[model samples]
Target: MKKSILTFSLAVSLLACSYAQNIVDGNKIPVAGNVKISLPQGFTTAIVAENLGKPRHLTINPDGSMYVKLARAVDSKGVLYLKDTNADGKYEVIKGFGNYGGTGIYTKNGYLYTSSNQEVFRYKLNANNEVADTEHPEKIITGLKMGRQHETKSIVIDNNDNIYVNIGAYSNSCQQEDRKPGSLGVPGCPLLDSAGGIWQFKANKLNQSYGQGTRYATGLRNVVGLDWNNTTNSLFVMQHGRDQLNTLFPDLFDAKTNAELPAECMYELKKGDNAGWPFAYYDPFQKKNMLAPEYGGDGKKAADASYINPVVAFPAHLAPNGLLFYTGSQFPEKYRNGAFIAFHGSWNRAPEKQEGFFVAFVPFKNGKPSGNWEFFANGFAGSDNITSASQAVYRPCGLAQGPDGSIYVTDDKKGTIFKISYNGK
Candidate 1:
């Protein structure tokens, strides 16, 4: 027994050494030094941490510390506090808080806020504005509905102390039969009453319910990415465009059209705003909200003017999951006030090579989108083309900007955090 135990310990030590040696040798992993991610000419990239288990949204503190939310609990711990004590651009100190997990997390005013799929909570902060009293967090909002699809609750807090949460529609198209081919859309989609929109509740208020909240916007199918744009003092969101355009309506749409129609859109939201969803979709090619075929559209008719249009539109099914407005001066001047969106990449664009497993930028001027959106960083997937989601090496999931103007990205697949900085090359 003693010899067996000794052998096992020696084997474990050898394995650890081999892994560290691989990293030192600049092999493909530990993924920090030579991860194959491509940034702009003047920017450099490094993996901040890895093996983080389904990391979701992340926020950087004023002091460059970070708080990340995981999609599920790890050893009953969901929230992570990370610190880079040595200033080596790698986070070395890691701490865990609360045995709950969800997709929303942020630090503001004097507290750290996080959420579960069906509730939102806040923890008091220490003097340094870092996490404190984590285990006994106060529940700010409760009783939210989370279904099987689009169940993650992404969150953002505004300047006025209002917190916004997305309640995604569970059904694919609000169809009468729900994704059944040839089924018509339910008129006046009842799902809009509860899901399919953003809701506003007081950030300081405790135990709030859906009945106590106000519907800020309607007709957004599923908004996984949203941010409070301080420049405009309003809410901005990226709507994941609906799917199966050709699979459901083969008579009207072809495989190529299904893969590329109905653009993923970015919208600057205001009170009572409505960005059309089940009833209509924005066609990037036509630059108009085309009536949905499920709603009697023959693939060409435009929806009425009652629906609000998007500020910017991207290719279909790219799954924009993170949004950050650059207020830092790290990169070139063009990046200031511009928006960085992390496309989680596409799983539905079958029969066509997938794209958008990278961070994209949309330049903004005077609080609105100014120029066309472009690729800010690429190569997250480690290849030029991929036919499926499993082939993706790292899917960009969340984004944040550090105090020195560096940007951070999170991957849900391997739970990796990547940091990108401008070196002024």
Candidate 2:
């Protein structure tokens, strides 16, 4: 971790222009004025739009229009429809609609789908593949539980027309008293009954409820970032690991250990797979799943193998907000089936310097990770040192690929939309 930080810092220090070539991917990514973000070689970035009011998740249409679900609504409308009238690749025309604000937005099966904190809705598309009826969207799924904590309902759709939604657990760790020191976990976490996992429903079905949907997997505390990996033909999700280990269980772990112990896990989920949360967490440093202190195990004891392991584990609390599988042909061949994850960065890595305000790449081949994760984009924090998230200039919360094989990323803080494209070098 120290080596990765040092290398990234050195790269940032050396670059002195509007763009710099990333040695990893050999792409010349852009570095806008005062904003310190960077991308790989041959690839370039442009600020396509700005000030859209905290855009969360986004989707790009075949006609080069875009829809971003805002974290907060503007003028009673939550979704922003951006149109690129010219072929210069900037979304010059922007409009807003949809009465509520939330984290999920997607386009699938000739419809544009979105979610609020508690419901999933879809709008029909016309011949242009844009939302045909913005004012009257049909409710596809209803009555989703929103506990007001970890309650972002991210949405993903598979090729089979099954739409999966993440129902985040309300409690931080299912403790008898949440976030309090020495509080034991509840025996049978009731939170998992109605929350804490992904639920699957028919994308074409309307007005589906919990009884109508299937609990595809269980024991995920909260998942903000998820996508349908077509190459693997499976659902992949990013679980936000449980927090406050040192503050809650002071004797079991120290501040440094608390900051780094449990990994933010990425699981390639199948039907009935449980990536154990609240009960256990993956220790990336130890490379094993450790039993939670609330579950009556010492910090050193490993969790039982009944729980599924993550395909990859990342540094904890970086807030993995968006996940996209690269199927676009704009980049070199090495990036074809790999994954790009945008980290919203960390706030609680305190007592140590906060990290991870950047986009990361994990190379994959034939549906499996082939190499270690590396920073494909970096420097969103605006400085090498950051003790608080509010000090960071931009937070990349969402990702989408365009029809021309370029990619777009969203910033929830400044509401900036950036497009990264290949120059075909």
Candidate 3:
């Protein structure tokens, strides 16, 4: 067979030159360079692209190209479109098209959008903005109501064309049977009317459904990171805090206060803003907003006053997912507009060693949140004693920002895509 196809094309060109000689001085990447991350002083990381399968939300391309979004499909496509063509920041061509999966992606104006836990599409781009009918997208919003524990929609877009979307809350505490440990909670949580919160629609309208969008913010209990913070024009989200909690109040939380009492918020929203899930939660050790033992709370109580609190919180189950907001400029100046967040770590926080798979930072100034939110990129769960989540090896989820001010992250476990840059030492 022609010498076994020339010995399998010379063993795939010597395994692509031993994976490009594992980059050395130039593109870094020894495990996403800066040696297992810990960025801050002069920054520096790489890896660019790797496996890529479950890569959730991502966006970019004003010309830099990225457009990810995939919680499933790959050969059946779920939108990929990488492109770097030798700029050396990595990417190298790649491509895929949309079919339907879920996670939520964005672009705006020229259009690109994405989503699928039950609909919300849109493509049309061309003129170099890429994606112009990658197999006809356009569904703009449909059904949307899938659940079994926070369905993973995660979308965002605002500049007035609107389009939010999040719909989680399938019951972790709205109880009455959901997390049935001591059960109870169900006085008002009518599943928050239709799955937790944040809805809003009409990004050029189209198929629209699920009561034609509008919820815009209600007791959010599962917002895999959202964005649209045009310097505080609003809409920020992150919430994913509400799980077990001492396996359902074992006589008022224990097991290390259920691995550190509730927290993991971030809010910022508006147009109704609720924040309190299943009655209330945010308790970074009584920073307050409590009352959630299925609504009778025994662990210190508090809530009421229509809930609302979190403008920051963090540190309970980690699992943030992704949310950017830097606004480019290549870095420095205290990361311009600030706010990165990508967590995606704890799978229930076992005995507690596993923390957010990292990529945090906050800092925003005139739009709120300034100072103290640190951890600009830490090691993506390559392991810090993660007792579970399949032993963890990269799980930061998704986040983008490159135009020059590099910061791409994505890594739904083994799908890589790092980046990080800074250099001005």
For model 3, where is the 10-residue window of minimal lDDT? 19-28
What are the clash counts of all predictions, listed in order?
A: 0, 6, 1
Model 2 regions lying over 4 Å from their true place:
1-31
Worst 10 residues of 2 by lDDT: 15-24
Return the TM-score for each candidate structure. Answer: 0.91, 0.92, 0.37
Q: How high is the lDDT of residue 286 in model 2? A: 62
Once model 3 is optimally superposed onto the true structure by TM-score, how far is the C-alpha of residue 3 displaced, in angstroms?
71
lDDT of candidate 1 over 318-361, digit per residue (tens): 99999999999878999998999999998776676887788888
- Which digits, one per residue and each the tens of the lDDT, describe model 2 over residues 67-130? 8999888898899899878777568646678889899999987899999999999999888877
- Ranked by TM-score, the better of candidates 1 and 3 is 1
Per-residue lDDT tens digits of candidate 3, residues 85-203?
87777785377987777888888888888888888888888889887568877788888788866787888888989888999988777888887688788798777887788889889
TM-score of 2: 0.92
lDDT of 1: 0.85
**Stretch of 10 with least lDDT, candidate 1:** 19-28
| Top TM-score model | 2
